[model samples]
Target: MSKHLLREISENIVKGDSIRTKQLVEQALEEFTPEVVIKEGLIPGMETVSARFQSCEFCLVDVVVAADAMQKGVQILKEKCRKEKAFAPKGRVVIGTVEGDIHDLGKNIVAVTLEGAGYEVVDLGVDVSPTQFVKAIAKFQPDLVCISALLTVTMLRMEDVIEAIKEAGLREQVKIIVGGAPVTQSFADKIGADAYVEYGTNVVYKADELLKKKGRRVALIQLPSILKEKHQEIFRKLFDFTPTFLDQNNRVILQGEELPECCRECREWNYEHNAEKTVVYSCPGGLSIIEARIEGDSIKLGKIICGPFLVETPGKVCVCAPGAKKVSSLELEKIAIFTQMIAEQIQIESREKLLQVQLEDQREILIRALKFQEELKNALNEARYRSLQSQVNPHFLFNSLNSLARLAMLEEAEKTEKFAYALSRILRYILRNIKSTVRIAEEIEIIRDYLFIQQVRFTDRLSVHLRIDEHIYDGLMPCMVLQPLVENAVVHGLEPLEREGMLEVSGERKGELVFFEIKDNGVGMSSDKLREISQLKISRSGRGHTTGLGLFNVHQRLQHYFGSNSGLEIQSQQNKGTSVKVFFPYIPQ
Candidate 1:
């Protein structure tokens, strides 16, 4: 029983049960040296469990439970190992479920197996967002970025995270391994992911392959075998570096280190002095080189050699030097294609970043619009606020005018018929303009009738004039926009003062927006009043006869038609006249 318990404790440590592992290790230590227990019982037990798990002899839970037991046993020996700290991690890896995915069983299993293999595993929990993955990459700067996604929908999001890395130009820095139920080797290829493993157990081999390639590439580049231990400044510069090459007859003849003859030819006419080895390389197009060689080690081609040559046949390697190792031209082409793929990946990542920013901006704008809309809805719900059409008190205007006409008839007033004619025209425009939208000309005509009626009512006290630019009458506007402003002008500007007042109405098209202005030289509003009225959320308050709904309601209607920027602007003082300028986006017919 004790031997079995000790064996179980060792398995748990290998499986990453840091919690239960210590307990079992301590229990095992009561009977043996912490070191002896770890060697004879713990290590061997974990090896057995790992084989069983990998070979399908043990199920996932079986492995996990055994790992938990093993962790407890390792803890008992940890104090002794600390004094003598001898074991080295097999490898280190950082793993996570990709952005927008929550499934993690596969990832967890892989983490366990990697731990069992003596690797230090950083298992980031599920549903990791792209930003989180990027931050983790930046933080740990791990040997690999292992991403898992269960759903096809979520798997695609991993492409975005990869793009983020590419944009930062970190694609070549860390290897990327992807896996999930929906993921395939093709998907991995399509996204430029380094490797794709289908099963958790398979990840062990995949990691080994990836790490080996990484090491070989580093060795080929003649850099440090352990890339992770390089100086931070070197890594920073390395990440930013890109390599370009020259090819001969569809063969990669020269890596970036050597200058191609084509480049020297282009520079032959120029006046730059330099002494360096010359070689051949492909430029932007088929083959023409520009620019002097930059100072640095050409990562692939060891030393700087300069010259140009052509390949005799396909699949032939361009010999930079007779004895140097030759690289397959096809392989070089794949590398070049990979560079372009990296650039495109970067562009995609930038777009996603921009999209995220736009969404945030739109959300803020929508929130403000909703607040303004709520305020307008509340103002429109008032009991006394009548529709603009009904607010003019048409019955009162007609009855008063009729009584005056009867008296004028008895007295034979000179313009009695003309006065009645103007009133009829005004009422016709008001009753007929029902559609929410109408041509600018139709709206202006409505204003014309309203002004004519105002002139008749206060012929001597009010002087109304309209001067609309011909270009302004070609667009469309909300129906009745002009009439209400005219009403407000006559009622508030002219009626409030005994002196004669002048009201001018005009409009013009400015780019994609239509601008309307109503100028009144009547008792202008106080600064406080103007400020309150200019605010979109202020309630409309005035006497029953002077219900403050006219200007307020017009403001709301303009906003409803064209958005918040469509509201009125009052330029006024207590005595000076007020000028209300309204702007609406012109929807061209």
Candidate 2:
């Protein structure tokens, strides 16, 4: 049993079978410790996959599938492992996509990489504002801050991020790194970022490096390599010393005192180049080294101490003023290559995840569809069975009232009384079973009586025309169709128009087909908006939420009774008129 269980775990991992991985993990629960499975089997497997991923021997898809396989087992093991093992958080990092950009792929990739590298990563998601980042920083006090963006428009958000950090008074303590398609070293430097990484993998590396380099004063290296001989002499004359000094790492460090005046032009240029750029000191409360690129030149000046005059801060620092050179095509190409590689790896990882998600979703949909079909079949069978067993559903009662009205009218006991009695009964029935289907003839009579009542309600402000064919008298239709259609034309359509409008209702039967048409010459819908009406699925309710379900409900009921091919057809032209035609196959007794 032990050997078989071990083989099961190994086989699932070697095959990169996520489903099997889940099965193995479940089976292992009876005997093996969750910690043993996680630490010995899953974690080691993931480590190998990550290595294969880095070596390019295994594409990101393979690695991700392997990761998912591991995650499946790890998830089951995690809760148990928490109880069984002492787990320590490997430093926290807060990450977000900057404001105005909604892209999350880059940020998600970085987060996954950071977690894989054993750091606890808190993802703040996308479109995060400066204040939000600052608040997060203050709350988390993370070892590092990571910001990402994809669009050029939102790239300016990095400056906002910098300002937010400064405002929180934790700017010095937190090391900041920026990356994305549009982010560059110049942008990072301008925004006062501690570092800028080109890719997600590099993000992990940068975070680690920044953590190691924390508390150590980094020398600002000047670009002494690009200064022309003549410019170097002029610089020497102005400063009475060499403008470049190589600190420990060949980074140019400049004298803190000599840099203030020379840096004024570049500060103005910073403002000129970037709207968000301001001449903020290198450090908020302490003198610190800075590298400033001379504007519109191919020279970069190395490090200089920037602070209050005569505040002597002792430190081994080098200032080298490099030539102010436009970033060459070669350098831009390198950055692009690295970003694209990272994006590709991320894309592969995302695809694997998407595929798994799609498979799961498809399984759920299939199950749901099968269940719905069964319910629909049972509903249809029940409906037919009920139809056979039932006698008359108030429709017969309505006709009996009409007959009673005729008899009363013959006796001459005031015609209005008989009409009112019939009206009250019809209204009561319609209110009772708003969802039930009635015979076509009965529905037509209801419409006729409704129109008669509305003529009295609106008092000559409205008019109605109704016609019916004898052949459809026995066909089934939902109650309240004609009344609501007419009501719609009057209340929403014709009432809004000042002109006297014509409302027409006609019905006919051609062979086995029953057709009902309602036309109104009032305010009509435009082509664009009218097209949207068909797609609208509204709920039928008397008062709650304005269900907008009147005509739509009638249409759905028609289709429900007479198959999908037979339903409502509506047409309208703006400010002219609207027409609705209902077609259904008449099934005779």
Candidate 3:
């Protein structure tokens, strides 16, 4: 009848029916204890919901609704227990997401699961910095602290939290657990966490296991010679009897041959080789006494035979023999329990060592991967920069050849020779500097050569002005940054105007940055064209008819070298003028 009521309560919680769950808890209180209701009813229901959520049978909204029901049910039980003075928390847990991470769904779920397991949980919510976690540790004094992060960027803060706790001298007081989407077991180990759980439901069991195994008391005994002088004190504390060893043939090796009459008789019987063929045996008074106990005698014997048990460290086999005093059943039970705890502790230590080795192997692999990724990124950037440089060089050469051909056709030999000389200088500059950056003075010399060629082509229709700050002559910039913008102004802005067009190039140093401006009083762009160019969506009507490719190429290279802050800014008014400003970091030569 009690089982049926508990099942109904569990089903209601799963259904997220809060009213029904509260009523069931109140009703169950009359029959079952609060501990029984929590363990059997609420916890089991939550476990089922968590399993469903992990399997994708339930979504976040469904889990939230179910958690609401669970919370309501727990609150009613807490109130009831408080009035009756029966509330006893299983353990205390502190949980939060690390600094810079605002994602908290996973952290919240784990916190609720710990609460459902009867732990007193203190939830420090999302974006909890390292200092906050250390402060909470001092205030809460929890058995476990859980750190969570969903992003790779924020996941590193878990290590900071751990180091803070260590610095605060609170590391030993609590066990730390870390988890999130980007978190792995190897990462947790690297950060010195106590345990890492991939799933929320597993947090409950792992927390319980860690708390139980940590700081446990066990009796340790040295081996090989069980009668060693150092072990004498431990033996005396655990047993009244002086222990003895037996070989595989069941021959008794007494502590000393100080013979009691019973031990002499027992050794004689064993010398006749009449002991039963078994792993362990209990000795009685002679062969007759052993047979009597096997036949259901309740007599207390003077000494009992125990063992064929194994001990770690230096391995050996040994049997135990009680002292001259009579052995009781309770004393035998104590001996059994003590040995068992030692065996369990050894197994736990062995598993931890194996896991540490695996974590180290994983850490090595991650380090190699990160190094390879950095190399690959550099290679891709170089390939992209070279590709952009290739496009600009060919386009400039074709236009210069066209200007030279027009002068040749007009039969002007002296002007043709001058144009050819300037073209040669520009070509020589581009060929020599295909790498990333060059001095501002060298770049300005190349720009002057380029503008001279354009001015010779346009003749009276083009006019030029230069305003350069002498202090900024040593600053560095990309190789061909100025040539493309100047070419655009001469070809699109000045060439289209019938009257004389003016082009101005200016440079100045502003704090850490060097600013260059190219202003032209000619045909400027419309709002649509300006917007299109700013977005790198230039139409065929723009300068060079290359669809903004040259501007885009220059912009990309600027950003690549000096980050996004150092790039082009363009302002233009149709039929009035256009001004293009370029920014570069002032790296002194």
Best by lDDT: 3
For residues 129-246, write the lDDT of model 3, one tens digit per residue: 8878876876677889999986564577799899977766667668999998778999999999999988765788889888765523111111122223333334455654334433
Candidate 1: segments with Cα more than 4 A from true spot: 1-414, 536-549
Task: Write model 2 residue lDDT over 442-527, tens digit each, in one string.
Answer: 77777676666666666667777777777778877666666677667767677787877678989898656677788998899888
Can you list the residue pairs that collide in candidate 3?
A: 241-323
Judging by lDDT, tell me the better candidate of 1 and 3: 3
What is the lDDT, from 0 to 100, of the residue 187 in candidate 1?
86
User: What is the lDDT, from 0 to 100, of the residue 266 in candidate 1?
Assistant: 56
Ranking by lDDT: 3, 2, 1
Flag regions of model 3 displaced more than 4 Å.
1-414, 539-549
lDDT of 1 by residue, 223-286 (tens): 2221121222331253332233322122332343344444544533322222233223542222
Provide the overall lDDT of each model, using Cα atoms, as 2-decimal numbers: 0.59, 0.60, 0.66
